[model samples]
Target: MVTSIILMNVERSKINEVAQQLADTEGVSEVFSVSGTYDLVAICRVPTNDDLSELVTRGLLTIDAILKTETMLAFKAFSRHDLETMFTIGLDGI
Candidate 1:
């Protein structure tokens, strides 16, 4: 899986609506309404780079309220959930 994080700035009146829309969009795994230089952050996962392009350029950029975005492509991922799953293998019933 390819993972990308998009830091987004939406129109002040439309941040919530844009975040909700992005959360529902295919390939977008999560959307966070945040405080700082950006109004929202969207986490996307896709099978290939082409899909990632289509999602960011065609899907996300097309949203009317979205003003600008800075995207970061993740090269590696480390999460507590992955560690937990790894350690719990074969221990389902205990």
Candidate 2:
């Protein structure tokens, strides 16, 4: 899976509406209103790079209300699967 974190500069009043729209998008998993240079942030997941690109090109960039965006592709994550499978408990005499 490919995941991206998008930071956006959105109009203050439109922040909520825009965030909801992003959250509802098929590839977007979550959205948050943040206090920073950017008004909103979104976490999105897609099957491939192409889908991620499509979402940025078609889903996000196409909107005028979205003044700007910065996208970061996730390289790592913490989860039960990663923790249990990657770490091994010592089996030798202790």
Candidate 3:
């Protein structure tokens, strides 16, 4: 899976509304309201890395309400959930 963290700059009042809309999109996994240089942080899962780029360029940039965004691609993730799924038969370590 090609995952990207999309930092969105949105109007504070419209953060939730924008997040809700992005959450319904096929590639978007999660959207959270945050306080920072960006207003919302959204997680997107695409079939490929190229698709992730297209999504940010074509889709995200096309939205007028969105001011700007900084996308951070995760090289690897160390999570309990991922570890469990990777070891279906159960591993020696928890």
Specify the highest-TM-score model's number: 1
Candidate 2 structure quality by residue, lDDT tens digits, 18-51: 9878888899988999986999889998999999
What's the TM for model 2? 0.79
Query: Whole-model lDDT, candidate 2?
Result: 0.85
Better of 2 and 3 by lDDT: 2
lDDT of each: 0.90, 0.85, 0.82
TM per candidate comes to 0.83, 0.79, 0.78
Scanning candidate 2 in windows of ten residues, the lowest lDDT window is 79-88
Candidate 2 C-alpha error for residue 22, in Å: 0.6
Best by lDDT: 1
Stretches of candidate 2 off by over 4 Å are 79-94
Ranking by TM-score: 1, 2, 3
In terms of TM-score, how similar is model 1 to the real structure? 0.83
lDDT of candidate 3 over 7-87, digit per residue (tens) = 989866777778887888778988998886889899898999889978888877656678889999988878535455567
lDDT of 1 by residue, 1-94 (tens): 8999999989999988898899889999889998899999998999999999999889986799999999999998775344455568696634
Backbone clash pairs for candidate 3 read: none
Query: lDDT, candidate 3, residue 5?
Result: 97
Tell how far residue 46 is off in model 1, in angstroms.
0.4
